[model samples]
Target: MHDSYTEFILPFGSSPNILEEYTNASGGIRTGKLMEHLDSLAGSIAYKHMLGPGVETVGNTKEMGFYIVTAAVERLDMLGPLNPARDLRLSGQVIYTGRSSMEVVVKMETMPGEFDEKEETILLGRFSMVCRDAHTHSARKVHPLAISSPEEQMLYSKGEDMKRKRQTRAQQSLSKVPPNSAEAEALHTYYLKYGQEEELDDISSSSQLVSMGDTRVEKCMLMFPQDRNVHQKIFGGYLMRLAYELGFANGAMFCKSPVRFVALDEISFKLPVPIGSILRLTSHVLHSNASSPQLIHVGVTANVVDVKTGEEQTTNEFRFTWASIDESSQRKVVPETYKEAMLWLEGRRALEMGDEIRGLRTQK
Candidate 1:
């Protein structure tokens, strides 16, 4: 169904693959697994688009195979929670394309029953995937997308707009030098306090500094064949799920209560994790809203470790925002060491960027 653009629907029923028992107060289908599905579905749509219509029997060669890796998740809004009984319906399409990358928009909804006419949106996300040669492992040019209908044209334009906005926001957040803006100045003064006082080595310190050790939440899992993608690498979405869950737990621990996920800012996949690799996910509370005590930001880092050598390489970094489940849950977070201070700055940068974009969206 590749002509220039292609779309498809993937339906999945509740299974152990996507469901996990909650060890906390929050209970729902595993979101990480759902994200993995979304990534796989998007990759499928991109592959279908590459295999133009009427083109059958494409050889699985480095130059011909349409292997794609998720480069980044621009944004994912969890409009609602996933219900286990409901069948997951992922409607995805190749919305836009560049020289070697394609933009895939996937809308995840759930049908209450087999014959249910109405579906509820669980979450919707935009993924950036780059095509790569199967053997050479380099970026490969993708088939250009064609826009025929006005609706298609509108979506294509919207994709371009989002791309530009992501670029601008990224540039603003990744400045090498500290920004001279008032917000950055404020954060500068805040971080300077860390250097002024003796670093606390324990979690029981009376200072505003929250022990980095206290905020750490680590989860390790064995990557199974079930989570492998077409290329046999661990799915980016699965890594996302792991990061999300760990980040959720970190937020909860920091707030001393259950935390509700509000937004996933940006998730960047640096390298693909191979199947059978030991996946170690580490999450920590990097920053907390200074004004809104209930808002917390956590950073999740995924590392693939060599089981034999015990060496590790970073794979992906996920940033998530969560709010205290209870309105009465209020607390502030501070870094206890220079290392943790740097992490706090990173989180603050992302949080400020998100707030800036959100403000602009509200104005629009």
Candidate 2:
């Protein structure tokens, strides 16, 4: 009776008081966006566990938690168009371990309730999570004893098996895309437009993405808890936070400095993440262009899945733009190392779309 992930201790079989929990949201049972749920789940977990046994060691290590997704898979059964109800459960298990980074096995499912039917799996996936202590709120290190128990060893082994599969999938997704992928083209155009227009009113933001001179820098850390709503499973907020961190990371990567998050675009909680499920988070450099208040856009996608059931519990995608103020030259600059080709391609598509839209507008 042991939960297994990989490399590190998942800290299972231990009791530290359920940090959070979530249930089905119906008839206004839940309110607020998905990011809030992520916040609550992560907050509850950090408050209780990461801070345990060695409060001094775990103190203020938020940035160390920035998680990058490397792989994902979903079963996605065809419900067709029946009652059309769904359920979700999520799990995070370590699949790969580097010197300082690790990958987690993430999945999602239809948690049974109300209209929830039997034998339905919506999504399955895996992700890469890099643990570092540079950009977050404090010093960082993965808990050595985090999975030191005999029970944890088993979870770690399972995670290793999953790592091989997940790595395979990640490579396939990147290399095997269609030649004329509408999805890829659409993503490029959408991001370009999003980069141009989005403005922030949320003063909470300290900076934004405008440029990328070069190189890749790590940004944003995200955390998920085993308990979600305290009443039910997990909330959509976890999804949003994943997106936010992705944006934050991308923005910082572009500027090579800390970036503040101002706004999120078109976030929909297709599914809910559950407590105890591992979360896979990703932040990628999408596009960075134009000087003088340059703009850099980052994309965020999250997948949560069940560890025991091998089912998917959460899936969502979002776009984020981070901005910054140039200090030395008094002008914004974006470092464009890993993002050159992608950014150029995105710009080309956006330019095409703009031309088409303008052509249509003139016809009218």
Candidate 3:
């Protein structure tokens, strides 16, 4: 684990030009742009683990015989707000490894301030990377992780558990099976309360519920070669940034207020989007909490559009949670169709997990 450990520093505080590139409209660091950097950092960590730390260049893929690709982003949680006024450090190591896959956990922290001499963690994320044979384009074996300490052992155990949970969740995906009994009952209850047009039309109803379909925000753009990775394909990080920005916009539109990013619940890279493909990103408010400190779960799907055939193939799916900056925001999302209801339940589950993780952190 120590051999694979890596760190990169972004001097946002000291570099005016660098900070300017990352600044959002509101003067805060751009979370989506930060995600791109994190993805790149994870890739670097994975390579450093496979190659020696002293290796400076990847050289040639043909000579290396194997290449890495991001399989999925397990989760990225915001433990604290980003401070553009301070330098930031990104660091992580290869915590676990399978025959052909590596689990890399990366984190972002604010550098110690002049008055406060302790660094503060701001973000934590896990990236799943897979190695493929350069010639055969098949799974390639990766070096095993060396766990020497109890702390390293614990992290390895956690990574193993995460892989198992991912498999279980995939088996129980709504596309493959019906929701469990409790989720079905809850959906029925929600339908009775908000699915009926008559109930929603009643002026006496205090709930400000909006149909999930009404909260959509979309963008279509041509994928350029300039955005390609080493493989000459569209970079996973670029797709992540696009999905995140779309989700953020959808959340803000649904809440009618500026939103603070809470978490990137999950991202599945189904297929490698080719360069020059028309990329379409569609986002929707999948679920919402109307209580104070309103929370919204936004889902985004990225598709590769076939211009000649007028068909679209989904290449990626992303789930993100955002909270309204105004605690008084009280908008809620209601599903009008079975498919939408399933998405609502999935988003709810993601938010619940985020809440549980945050609760655990607070206890620590």
Candidate 4:
């Protein structure tokens, strides 16, 4: 872990030009751009772990024999707000390794004021990277991580648990199987409460339900080579930024107010987007909470369009959570079809996980 440790500093406070590049229209830091930096940093850390700390550059992939690619982003949680006036440090290390994959943990923190002052972490994320043989494009074995301390051991254990949980979740995915009895019952109850036209006609009721379909926002563009990664394919970070911006827009439209980004719940890279391809992104408000500090769950799907056939193949799926700034925002999303209902349930699950993770962070 120590060998793979890496850090980079963004002098947003001291360098005006640097800050200008990252600043958004609202004067806050662009989380999407920061995500690109994180992805690059993770890749560097993985290479450092594989090629040793002394290696300055990945000289040649063909000569090096093996290269790494991001398989998935497990989760990225916002622990604190980003302060544009302060310098930020991004750091991480490889905590766990499998036969050909590694779990890299990264954190974004504000630079300390004094020498003795501790940095305040603003974000935490985990990235899954897999090593591939350059020639065969097949999985290549990576060095096993050495566990030297109890803390490191605990982190490794957590990484192992994450992998298992991912497998379990994949097996239980709605695309593969029908919802269990409990989920079915919950959907039935929701339908009875909000799906009926008579129930919707009751203006006296406190519930303000909006159709899930009504909250959709989409963007379509041609993928350019400039956004390509080392593999000559559309960069994962670029795709992430696109999806995030779309989700943010969709959330804002649904809430009718500016929303604060809470967390990037999950991102799955199903396939790579090729250069010069038609990329289409569609986002919808999957779930909404009417409680104080109302939260909205946004889901984005990225697809590559076949120009001749007019067919689209899904390449990625992203889930994000945003919080409405206005306390009075109380519109809840209601699914009208069985497919939408399943998506609603998935969004609710993601929000529940976010809540649990945030609670744990607060306790810590």
By lDDT, is 2 or 3 better?
3
Model 3 regions more than 4 Å off: 200-207
Please give the CA lDDT of all the candidate structures. Answer: 0.72, 0.41, 0.89, 0.89
Q: Candidate 4 vs. truth: CA RMSD?
A: 2.3
- Count backbone overlaps in model 2: 74
TM-score of each: 0.81, 0.33, 0.96, 0.94
Error of 1 at 28 (Å): 3.0
Instruction: Supply candidate 2's per-residue lDDT for 126.
Output: 34
lDDT of 4 at 81: 91
Expressed as tens digits, the lDDT of each residue in 65-140 for candidate 1 is: 5577888988777677666666667777877888998888878777767666477876767888888888778789
In candidate 4, list every pair of residues with a backbone clash.
none
How do the residues 176-221 of candidate 3 rate in per-residue lDDT, one tens digit apiece? 9999999899889888877788865652354477878778888999
RMSD of model 2 against the true structure: 17.9
Which TM-score value belongs to model 2? 0.33
What lDDT would candidate 1 get against the real structure? 0.72
Model 3: how far residue 341 lies from native, Å: 0.8
Kindly report which residue stretches of model 1 are placed more than 4 angstroms away from their true locations once superposed: 1-27, 53-63, 81-88, 110-122, 173-175, 189-209, 290-293, 307-310, 337-339, 353-364
Candidate 4 Cα errors over 4 Å, as ranges:
114-118, 199-207
- Please provide the root mean square deviation of candidate 3 (C-alpha atoms, Å): 1.8
**Candidate 2's residue-wise lDDT over 82-121, tens digit each?**
1123333333344335544354443334444454346443
Between candidates 1 and 4, the one scoring higher on TM-score is: 4
